[model samples]
Target: MTDSIRHLSIHIDRTRDDVYAFASNPENLPAWALGLGGSIVREGDEWVASDAPMGRVTVAFVPPNDLGVLDHDVTLPDGEVFNNPLRVITDGTGSLVVFTLRRPAGATDAEFERDAEMVTADLARLKELLESA
Candidate 1:
């Protein structure tokens, strides 16, 4: 079974266009993405990240207000490669961002949960930055 976790109904004080612009641009990723290592860019229709743990990431989807998804194969400090999927959705008021990490099939669940928590906090930080600006 593919387990999925959802974080819905976050509210931020910003316009839809402002939020969309911030999230859609690859340049702004490091600004709000807490542990992100380096810069991001667009290669054709996909967003790509270089110098990050992932080495290079590909954007899976980008939509107006309904959805956006990014994926990467990240190399850990211990030399483990993790497949990371990030999803975002506008929730009328703010946005709901979900990050799903797929490790080796036999990997423990605890670490994945921890990673999800970290991403959730990062999203909260993003909300603060956008709303405050």
Candidate 2:
């Protein structure tokens, strides 16, 4: 079970398919994911992001599909895996992008809030980029 989970979402002024197609692509990770954007390097079938505060980590995202699932698993240098549950749901004429942020054990309130803020920023960036495209 997770220590705690925060569900953060942002409404994107775009089709669910379009938002999912763009966000679900690993090649586009750095475009919105703040920290990994400049250092996520692809190696064969895997991805490695260098210069992470915790050292280099591997990232693997589920393939994009019609159901709008954008879940991904990131492997820390310590070999711990963090699962991120993300989805794009249709709402009226636009789409809502929801991201689940699981609080790690022993994480302070500040840490958790910072993470939530980061995800919020990332999603906002996604919304802005898509809406203006």
Candidate 3:
């Protein structure tokens, strides 16, 4: 069975449009999503993260829309795919970014916690980058 879902969020002191514009761009993943390492490039229509922690991976995001959905699918080199649900919603004059992290099947408690920590750190990085800009 798969592990339970966990929702993590970070408040960015910026407009939703600004946040969404930055986060939705695949090229910007490396700047904030550290899990993708420090660089990502487009190969055909898909974004490729060649230095990802789990080796090279392909990320396919949803088409740009006004709904603030930033969902994407990451396919590992081993052919495993993970669907990631993410969004940037209005929060007063700023924005709130939420990421839904689901632990992979058969992951240990410690591993799940570690994944959460990594996501928290990534969101923190996003907040820092956007807020300071």
* Per-model CA lDDT versus the true structure: 0.60, 0.86, 0.94
Which model scores highest in lDDT?
A: 3
Q: Spell out the clash pairs found in candidate 2.
A: 30-37
Q: List ranges where model 2 is wrong by over 4 Å.
A: 1-3
Q: lDDT value for candidate 2?
A: 0.86
What's the TM-score of every candidate structure?
0.61, 0.91, 0.96
- Tens-place lDDT digits, model 3, residues 1-113: 33588999999999999999999998899999999878999989889999999999999999999999999999999999999999999999999999999989898999999
**Candidate 2 versus the native: TM-score?**
0.91
Which regions of candidate 3 deviate over 4 angstroms?
1-3
For model 3, the local distance difference test gives: 0.94
Q: Candidate 2 residues 4-109, lDDT tens each? A: 8988999988989889888877777777887564668888888888766678888888875789998889898889999999999997899999999999889998
- Considering only N, C-alpha and C atoms within 3 Å, which residue pairs clash in candidate 3? none
